[model samples]
Target chain A: MKKLNYGIIIILGIISFIPLLWVFITSFSPGNQVIKGGFPFWVSNPTLENYVKAWETAPFIQYYFNTFVIVFGVLIVQLITITLAAYAFARLNFKGKHVLFILFLLQLMIQPEILLFPNYQVISQLGLVNTKLAVMMPYWASAFGVFLMRQTFKQVPYDLDEASRIDGCKWYQTLWHVYIPSAKPTYIAFALVSVSHHWSNFMWPLIITDSVDSRPLTVGLALFAQSYETGAQWGMVAAGTVMVIMPLVIAFFIFQKQFVSSFMHSGIK
Target chain B: MAAKRKKFGSSSRHNLFAYGLLFPSFIFLTLFTFYPTLKSFQLSFYSGPMTRLQFSGMDQYKEVFSDEIFRKVILNNILFMIGTVPTSLFLAMYLAIWLNKKMAGSSLLRTSFFYPTIIPLIAVANIWLFIYTPQYGLLDNFLHLFGRGDTSWLGNPNTVMIAMIFMIIWKDTGFYMIFYLAGLQNLPRDVYEAAEIEGAKPFQMFRHITFPLLMPTTLFVMIVAITNSFKNVDHLYIMTKGGPDNASNLLLYHIYEAAFTNWDLGKAAVLTVVLIVIMLSITAFNYLYLDRKIHY
Candidate 1:
């Protein structure tokens, strides 16, 4: 039974990895060899031509810059907003605090896609359409972050807060010195979740950004593939897909423990 | 300073500070989350102009319900959910249990399963778009080894959703497995030991012990899966674009098409209203039925 379990897990792992392995191999393989695909996994003649072609085909440099700006911009703002809000909910006693937190919970059920029309209207009204700011604006505050932080903050011992406060710390000082450090795990978890989310986010960026100037990597990659110009260029598409996913994929490799632990922690939350 | 610190908990000044801290979040939440949700509902019943909405007394909702595309989208969403949610849930549980033991290369296997969840669905779909490409794609190429040839996976209305569901399950099951693993590890071991002492078979132990204890996690995963069913449409854009007569078109994709492609914000508002109502009912179900029962 134990051997069988191991076999099942190994099989599942192979099934999941096969597509990933193929994409990686195909990205390096020459276009002709990919079409021939009788060779198992490895290419007899791998080339960097597809990567070069994909790069020249799309403004990948600009897309990468825009993606960085939008992703970090949203994350920076969200950290501030979520920390402050979560602190209030976790530490402060106030009128309607519970109600306000409930409101935040209610937002969880309301997927952002449902608000696409109105958010677009708001962004356009602010004259921010077709810009990276427009792409980042709607997601600047995250309810999930607030919820996760609040839960983590509550788990923090009150003694820490009192210790900091008795040391002549301001209320914010207590949060900064005490709550923040104690909730560092939660912050890491939230940051990972948030970063990956915005990194891979396509629809909002696709809808908001019109040009290559503001288009993030996902939108840029989709258009790069589906422009019908490169529609049949499988190798190039594989290369572009690799370029887009490489950072996140590589990050997963380096921080494999943190990444998995973060998901587990947040999921259990 | 000691007195001041002690007074910090309930003082009116602390209340003021708390509100100050909350102000930034509330403002953005009001602008993006609360306001847009309320605005969507209001705009759903309004028509005639974008600048000035006139209350048209259910006309927009009526039209949205009558929309053939809307019907197709809702049907597609149901099919997508039915195809994905239970299958992924069980697969996640199965993998989590099998991988839970301390074994050689176990962590490596877990990472392999989860690797897809880290990549963007759009990028994954782009690779899959080629995989499903009619004659020369990977799947067809693999199938030819078995004497099968030339299937148009995404281009066909019949197979598009299945192709999509397969990719999606592959993408999600690993992530969900982590959740179930957490749940499984948290379960008390003594119950399992007692079950074993009573000569309980593995399936019997799972049926009575593991399954019941994992109910909370199941409910949580179910909520997440249902939400993902509606939320994830990135692949739809990259792979099929709700194509071949809108067979694979889901609700959010239709909303994107109606609002963006057709520039029909009024109809989009109507669809948004439908989405919110469905979301609300799900929330209600979770709170009323599932929340009370969850052991946590």
Candidate 2:
């Protein structure tokens, strides 16, 4: 029975890796023969020319920089906002707090797509359209982040708050020194989830930003593939794809244990 | 007593400061998120292009109902939800159960499954596009090996939606499986031990013990999965663009094309309102139906 279980797991693992392996192999295959499937696993003349073309065909450096700016900028703002919002919801006593909290939760219910038109209107009205800010604006306040932080904050003891207060530490200090420190795991969890989300976010960024100047990696690759219309140069496409996913993939590998555990912790919570 | 009064004063001030810190995010939510939602509903009454916006008073809504494309988009959304959600949830649950056992390299397997979830959907869509090619793609090659003719998976209107659904399931099941795995890990082992001692069959143990305990996780997963199905536009945008006679055009993709491609923001806003209404109703149903069943 145990051996059978291991056998099943091995099979599932291989099945999961098939697409990934396909992409990895195709990325290195000679440009001319990349699309032929009879030799899916064999790269007759592996070359780095595809990677060079992929890099030259677009300003991938600019794409990466734009994506980095958006992801990190949005994450920093979200961490601050979600922390405070979560604290207020979790610990504070105020009028209509429950009702307001429910209203906040309602954001999760409304699909982000539904808000695209109106959000675009708002961004364009703000004169922020075609800028990285337009891509980052709508995501500044994540309902999920708020909810997660609130749950994490609530798990922290009120005694800590009282003790900090007794020592004459102010509320902000208490939060900064005690709550934030204690909730490090949750913060890490939220960070991983948020960074990954923004890294892969495409549709909103696609709509909000018009040109390559503000375009992120995903949109860059998309436009590349779309323009290569005669036939998708599979080698370049695969190489570009590998470039796009490498950061997150490498991050995942380095912190594989934390990534898995964080999901487990956040999921259970 | 003086110190106590000073402390009380400081506490009130601190509370106000906390509220002040929260004010920006609250304002952001009201303006960008909630306000747009309200504006969408208001704009749903208008007709004509965005620049020529004029209130037509339910004409747009009426048009939405009459529009064949809108109907097809809605039907496609429903079909997508039906096709992807159950398959994803079931596969997740099954995989979670399998991984919960003490097996060698389970963590590695979990990571392998989840790696796809983190990759950009457009990138995956590109790879799958190649894989689905009629002549030289992997699927066709595999079919040839089985003595079957090459199939135009994405090109055919009949198979496009199915192809999209399959890709979605492939990408999402592992993510959902993590949730199920977390839920499984949280379940008390003693209950399972008791069932085992009673010589309960594996099916019986799962049916009686595991499924009941997984209700909350299931509910959460269901809500997320359903909403994701409704909101997913990337795959369609990259792979189909609602092509082959609009076979795979989803509601969200339709809204995107309407607003950006057609420059009909007024109609797009109406579609947005309709999409929100559909999604919120599902959320309400989830809350009404499943929330009560959650153990906590």
Candidate 3:
């Protein structure tokens, strides 16, 4: 029975790897021979031509630049807002704090998709449509980030805050010097989560950005794939897809343990 | 007397600082999130394009109830949630358990399972679109090995939702597995040993011990899964566009089409309100029923 269970697991693991393997092979297949399949395993005469073509066909470099701008912009703003909000919720004694915090939590409960039309209207009103800032604006203050950071902050001892206060440090100063420094792991965890999420974010960016000047990788790839009317040229699509994902993939691989643990920490509670 | 006055002033100043710290987030939320939500509700009562707005009272809601496409889209969304959530959850838990054991190359297996999670949904949809192709796609060719003929996985109206469901489950189960794995890791080792000493069989242990302990994680996973099933529209938008006769159209995608494609802003706003109410009430219900039961 144990042997059978292990066997099933091994089979499942191999099955999980197949789609990625297929993509890798199809990416390298020479020419438009992507569909000539006798098990996509053996790519006879693989070439780098598809990669070059994929690169030249689109403004991928611009897409990358736009995506980085949006991702980092959102992350920087979110780190400040969430940290401060979390600090207040965790340590402050302001009036109606609990009620206000609960109201903030309601954002987490509501689906972001439901807000798309209205958010679009707001962006249009701001004259931020077709811009990277439009993509970055709605995500500036994340409720989930606040909640996660608040939880992390609560775990730190009160003595540290008291000591800082005794030293005549103001609230913001204490937050910067003590609370933020102590929550490094939480910050890293949130950073990874935020970066990956915004990197893969599609629908909002697609809605907000009109042209290649502001389009991110996902939108760029989608438009690129759709432009191929005769179905996706598997090699080019795969190559393009790989380029879109490789940065996050490499980051995950390098920080596999941190990534997994962060996911676990954020998810389980 | 001097000390008392200083304390009062300092305390008031500190209160101001606390509010100051919270001011930016509240302002952003009010402008971007809360205001839009309220405007969505308000806009539901009007029916016109960008400039020509007219009040229609509850006419929009009435139309939503009577519209055949709206009914179909709601049914399709529910069907998708029903199909994907349980399958993904169960498979994730089962695989997570297997991977949690002391096994060689477990990290590699975990990474492979998780690779799909990191890939952008648009890209995944592109890859899966090829896979669902009738002749050269991996799925059809693999089925051919079992003496089956070519199948139009995405093109057939009868199979479109199911095909999308299958791809969704495949993409998400590994991601869910990470949560289950974390839950499993957090379980106390001694409890399992105690169950074993009490002569509990594997199934018995799972039923009486493991499942009970994992309930919180299960609940979290369920809520997240359902919410994701509702939010995920990119695949449908890219691959099917809720097509093959709108057989695969879910509520969110329907909302997108209504607002953007058809330019029926009022109807789209109505749909958005209904979607929000449904989602919020469901989440509220889940919280009311399951929140307190969450052990952690």
Candidate 4:
């Protein structure tokens, strides 16, 4: 039975790894070798030419810049908005709290991705189209972030809040010293999830941004790959694909445990 | 009277502070979520371009429902959901059960299964696009070993859905596995030991004990997987573009085409409303299930 379990896992593992492995291989193989291919599994002569050509073929530097600005830009704002909103939901009492909370939940369901058309209109009307801010704006208020943080904040002992209040700390001060510090793990978890999410986000960005100035790696890679379709530049496409995924993939490997647990935390919450 | 007024004033101040804290989130949420949703509802009733509008109640909705492409897209979306969600869930649970045990190389197995989850769907599409390409593609190259001829998997309507479904399962199975692994860790061990003493088989223990206990996790995973089915259409943008006569088209992709490609704001509005309705119903179902799970 133990042997059989190992066998099953080994086979499935190989299956999962095949595409990634093949793509990695294709990215390294020479352009001529790829064009001459019948599944070129190994490279007799590997080269960095594809990567060079892929970089030249598109303004990948600008795409990388745009992606970083958008991902962190969205995360920084989300951290603030979600923190404040989550604190209110977790601690304070206010009028229409129930109704407002339900309204917040509506964002969780009607995510901005599905609201592409209407959101585009909003962005256009606000004269923010074709800007990184356009991609970042709709996501500034993340319902999932608020929901996650609220769950964490609610777990803080009531005594802490009272103690801070007795010390003459204002509500925000209490939140800063008491709630935020204790909820460090939740903050990390939310940041990890949010960063990875916005890093890979495509459709809305694809729709809103027109030029390379604001297009993230995903959109840039898509257009770059599509441009090479008739030419069959699989090697360059693979190279561009690798460049787009490498940062997240490498970070994921380094932070494997954190990434796994963060996702798990999100699920459980 | 002085003390009561002080307490009342403090309570009101608390309310004001709370509202101030929530105001920022509400501003963005109202702009992006609430306003867009209400706009979609209103626009669905109007049948023209953005510049000129004539309110024609329910006409856009009726037209969208009757359109062949819209119906096809809905069916395809449902089919994609049916194909991807359960298969991935089952694989996830099965893999999680094995990995949950103490074994060497388990971390490797975990990484193998979970790595694809982090790779952007767009990149996954690019990788799989090469694999599905005819003649020189990986799958075809492998098939040649078994004497099969070259085939265009994505180009053929009959094969496109299955091809797409298989890629999606490969991409998502490990993701769902993490949740099940978490669920498995929280399961009581004593019950399994009790079942073992009674001479219950592994399958029987799973069916009778583990399955029953993990019901909440399964429900939660199901909601995520189902919503994912609606949301993740980036692959369609890369591979099929709802091609082969719109065989693999999905509702969100259809909405994209309606709104952007066709430049039909009215139709797009109607489609968006339909998507919203579908999403809200799923949330309603999830809440009902979650409420029940709390008592259970």
User: DockQ values for all predictions?
Assistant: 0.71, 0.63, 0.69, 0.83
Better of 2 and 3 by lDDT: 3
Put down candidate 1 lDDT per residue, A202-258, tens digits, no spaces.
Answer: 888888889989999999998888874243467788899999999999999999889
The CAPRI quality class of candidate 1 comes to medium
Give per-residue lDDT, candidate 2, residue B270.
80
**Residue B144 accuracy (lDDT) in model 3:** 87
lDDT agreement with native, every candidate: 0.86, 0.84, 0.85, 0.92
Local accuracy of candidate 3 as per-residue lDDT tens digits, A150-205: 99899889999899999999877888888889899989989988898899998888
Q: Estimate, for each residue in B120-208, the C-alpha lDDT of model 2 and write its tens digit.
A: 88888988988898877877877888898989899899999899998899899988998998888789989989999999999898899
Question: Over 4 Å off in model 3, which ranges?
Answer: B1-9, B294-296
Model 1: per-residue lDDT, tens digit, B23-116? 9888877888888888888888888768777889799888888988888889999999999999999999999988888888889999999999
| Lowest-sum lDDT 10-residue window in model 4 chain A | A31-40
Over 4 Å off, model 1: A228-232, B1-12
How well does each candidate superpose onto the true structure, as a TM-score?
0.95, 0.95, 0.97, 0.98
TM-score (2 decimals) of chain A in model 2: 0.94
Each candidate's fnat:
0.77, 0.67, 0.64, 0.87
Per-residue lDDT of candidate 2, residues A62-89 (tens digit): 9999999999999999998998898888
lDDT of predicted model 4: 0.92
